[model samples]
Target: MSAFWRDSLAGLCALLIGIGIARFGYTPLIPVLIQHHWLDAGDAAYLGATNLAGYVGGSLLAAWLSRLVPVARLTRIAMIITTISLAACMLPWGFLWFAPWRFLTGFTGGLLMVAAVPLMLSRAPPHLHGRSNGIVFTGVGIGVIASGTLVPALASEGPAAIWGGMALVAGLLTLLTWPRWTPQPGDASPGTRGTTRAFTRPVAILLVAYMLDSAAFVPHTVFWADFIARGLHRGIEAGGFYWIFFGVGAMCGPVLAGFVAERFGFYRSVTGGYGIKAAFVALPILSQHPVALAASAVVVGAMTPGISALASGRVAELVGFAAHRQVWGWLTGGFAVASAVAGYLMSYLFDSYGSYYMLFGIGTVGLCIAMLLSVFVRNPPAPAAQAA
Candidate 1:
């Protein structure tokens, strides 16, 4: 009914289903797939790598295609394609079929992500940006949390049956959202040609920072469970609990970021956020206490997502919002490529070393670097000050 409520609900739905298919759907189904003897651990790991590679490729495709297609239509198509592709995970009897489906899911997911994430940032009023992103991005955490709860319960039902159910759910959400997709505000903003100077410096800096942040996060998400099991001397239950906390913390992050940044400066908050995460990530290697490990994980997850919220909002502030989706898409696609390669490299390092210490060390360096880079970021002077 109200604009705020309407916008929030609509944006939240898009993020929930789109990212649900791209990231969270496969994990819960893994146990079911494992139970069915459909995929081995190595097969699953490689498939995950393949899926991220596809994510990079898809982001590039979306950027190229963004210039040709209107942003909303492109996004609608991406979500629909992703919803269909997610069901592809069920098609395979083994890794053979599952792999490409995962790839396709990654592809559609990346396209929709760039389309969805930046637009949501730009459309919400300035004050609401952090809270809005927090609410919408919580969809990934919700989907992941749901997967953890649902998959084990459905383990007996098998992959095909579970896939059928999820596909139906996604289909319904997409149908519900078809008529209500919000108008992208680029039409109201100045066109980009006169704004080329606005984009060059900030975009260059954010692009690099995003890439480093991506590399930094890969280890935590990809190997947090392993780090606990090997270094912390914990079993699957402990690992599971740790990941759930991280997910819940991440889900709550946007709200916390918005609140804290409102009081403290955004740049200062982000630097501190990155610094805190780096410390938390390195904590397990320093000591193996279960409670300490879990606490660190919560901090790591909570602080990291908010860093992105702060960073993306900074871009919109610095760059101006004309065809913002296209600009951010180009920027995001670059970061996705880095993210994909960085993720693959992180996994490769873990396998080669048979330890997580090096991985954590690399992540620490990345955050420190990003924090140092933040110094170059300054808000443009007021319009009158520049005129003077």
Candidate 2:
């Protein structure tokens, strides 16, 4: 097979193990953990925050290491670490162990995302970059679907069994991609920073918008399952069902975003996406009817990865490909910080007020602000001109 297919496959597997299983696996398992008395609501929030914090750390490290390590090696290491961390969560050692393990898993996710996303995009021919990114990120949805469907059934088996199962899946994916990760020749010099442009107004605006978009997603990613299962007194199975729809939306989000962005431009596509997402974010607050909630899941799920794919495309459009590796790291790190902050804040709100209304309200406001900011993002010059 061609290098393009191999790289894309490797990236998909990396994301599945990293973001899907390591970073997001915990969210679906929240209801199970709480029910099993393995963790309290507050502890769940703390664990989530800890994981995001580790993501921040790992992202920054990836940025610094981009010039030092090959993407293939970085990805391989991250996948292995993510697998180990997932297995570690299955240990009966309690929160002390769980916190570190979760953090480690998220750290690996951060590394994999920063390294693999741009790597995959860079490997694809320019015309296919947007779709390639969307395809790679689909792993997140696949992971979510697995967790949403598989974890609920495993809930009766206990946390150890559930976590162990996740580790096994991640390990298998890691092995599948392992042989193909041999270093590429001329994989860009480690230190070849993009001199095409510096951080300008548009880049700054895009980063802030991306950051807010990240924050806006916290309510759903961290708390949606818990909210349904615990907040609405819906059974875990119902919550899982909702989460499955969420994953389904995510699975398709990138492809839709890619098509729209290619036609309408990334700026318009992102603005419209955020607008739709913001509306859905407010849905549960207005009405928790099963239909409204389900719609909310589908819309929000689509936008989560959709926005990500669009944002990266926009970044590449603005900064040029040579700069993508470094810039992508900062963008992802900013998102991680936002996610961490939102996780802690929402966790506190849940503990103090026992409601998600305020969280969704805040998220809606943030998304609106992001949409407004996106309007200012002008299309950059053609890639050849930008690279020149």
Candidate 3:
């Protein structure tokens, strides 16, 4: 295969191990942990939040560390750390013991997410940027699909078995992608840094909207499987099936959103994506009918990554390419902070109320606010206007 494909595959593997397995692989296992008495419902919820918290640190760390370390080297080390964290979780020593390992997984995952895509994109030919991104982010969906399908099958064998299986998969991906990572000449140079004041009115509006999107999606990402399995009494198999639908939608979301953005423009596409996601996220609260649940699963899943792509493009449209990386880093950092906060807050509310309905309601409201905020985001001034 060509170098482009090699880099894309390696990036894909990094994401698959990082966000896919490290972050999301734990979702389906939430029900299993509670069911097996390895952890209570509240502890499981908190553990999930812990990973999100670790992700916040990792995302911030990746930005600073990239200046000091080669992006490819950092990504490789992250994957290795993520694999180790997965293996470490198999010990089954309880919540305190498992929390740190889960945190490590999230940290490494954040590092991969922030570092891996750029590493691949830097090597990609200009014409192939879009296609290469699709290939790389597709790893997230593949990882979700693997976890959603495999966890239930392994659940019968016990949680340790599930952890072992995930570790094994992560280990194989690490080995396969290891040598494919090559450093770019620019990797050694510390690039220009932009100020936070780049958050002009339009950019600030967009950033807030993006942060709300992060907060709104927490319900599905953190609690969907548990809601289906425990909340509805549907069992782990049923939960996994819906999660499979989510995975399928996730796989299609970014590509479909990219096409829509190219046609309709990123601004309108983001607004519509948020509106649609809000409606679907609230669907479970309105009705638990099998069809309603499936639609919710699919649409919300699609919007999760779909909206992200649109928002990133929207950022570029607002700030131009030179500042896009810096602005986008702020955007990403905001997202991680929101997700971490929402995850913990929702977990607390769930523990206090013992209901998933409130969580979905909160997500819906946040997205609705985001949709409104997105409507106010105007485009950047023309070059001539800026110069004047």
Candidate 4:
């Protein structure tokens, strides 16, 4: 195969192991953990938050670590650690024991999330950048599908089986993609640097909106499966069934967003996406009908990754390519921090009230604010040289 396809495939596997299985694989297992008495509902929620906390650490460290180690080497190490963390969970050593492992999983996932895409994108021809990105991110959706479908099937064998199965999948992916991380020349050098001037008013507004998206996403990402399974009194299988719709929407989201952005521009696409996301996120509060729930699952799932794509493009549009990386790093770090905070806060609220409705309501409100913020982000003025 050509280098583009080969590298894209490797990137896809990286995200599949990192973000897909390492980060999101815990959602479906939440209900399982509670059901098996491994952890009570509150503790289980707290454990999930721990992973997000680790993700914040990992995102903060990934760039600095990449400066010390090769990006490819650091990414491979992260993937290996993620696999080990998953396998370690099979011990059933209790919440304290499991919490650190989950944290490690999230940390490694953050490393991969930060390092893998750029590694692949740098190698990809400019003409193929869009397609390559879509291919890579599709791994996350595929991983979600696997979690929803495979986890339930494995849960029948017990929680240990679920952990082991996920670990096995991560391990297989690690091995399969191991050769692809061969370091190229200049792999050790810190990449292009963006000046502080890149932080313009429009960029700040966009950053805040992006951060809000992170907070808004916490409910669906952390608690959707548990809400359906335990909150609604549906079985794990039923929860998994709806989660599959989520996965399907996630799989399609990036491409759909790209298509819309191509026609309407990234700014408008992002604004409209937030509006649509707000409405769907509020759906569960209005009606628990199967169809409404399914629509909610699909639309919210789509916007999870969809908004990321739109926001990334918007950043590039606002700052130009030279500053895109640095500004985007700010955006990502803000997102990680916000997501961690929201995850813990929502977990606590769930523990206190035992209601998913309030959590969904919070997400909807956040998205509405995000949409309004996005609407105020006017395009930056043209550079004098370009205008001349």
- Backbone clashes under 3 angstroms, per model: 0, 0, 0, 0
> Where does candidate 1 clash, by residue pair?
none
Scored by Cα lDDT, where does model 4 land?
0.86
Best candidate (score: lDDT): 4
Candidate 1: which stretches are off by over 4 Å? Answer: 25-37, 118-130, 156-168, 182-196, 225-239, 321-327, 378-388
lDDT of 1 by residue, 1-388 (tens): 7665555665666666655445555544543454476775446556666777777877778655666776567667877877787676667567777777767767877766665555555567877766667777666666545544544455567777667666666777778767656455452221345345545665677678767777787666666754564446664445556666676766777678877777886667766777777788777677777777777777776765667666655555555544344456666677678767876787676556667788888988887887777667655334312422
lDDT of 3 at 53: 88
Task: TM-score each candidate.
Answer: 0.83, 0.94, 0.96, 0.97
lDDT of 3 at 24: 86
Candidate 3 — which residues are off by over 4 angstroms? 186-192, 383-388
Clashing residue pairs in candidate 4 are: none
lDDT of 4 by residue, 1-388 (tens): 9988889999989888988888888999999988888999999889989998998888777778888888988888988899999999998779999999999988888787777677887788889888887888888888999888887898778889999999999999889988889898744333555556678888889988888989998999899999899889998988888888888888889888888999999889999999999999999999999999999999988998888888888887887867766677678788888999999999999989988999999999999999999999866647511422
User: Model 3 over residues 131-178: C-alpha lDDT tens digits?
Assistant: 887788778888889999889999999999999999999999989988
Q: For residue 311, what is the lDDT in candidate 3?
A: 82
Badly placed stretches (over 4 Å) of model 4 are 186-192, 384-388
**lDDT tens per residue, model 2, 1-388:** 8877777877888888888777777788988888888888888878888998888888767756766778778778888888888888887776887988888887888888877666666678877776677778899889888888878889889988999999999999989989766677755533445533546678788889989999988899888898899889998888888998898898889889888987998778888988999999999999999999999999899999899888877877787766765666678889988888888888888789987888899899999999999988876756524583
Local distance difference test, candidate 2: 0.83
The positional error of residue 155 in candidate 4, measured at the CA in angstroms, is 1.5
What TM-score should be assigned to candidate 1?
Answer: 0.83
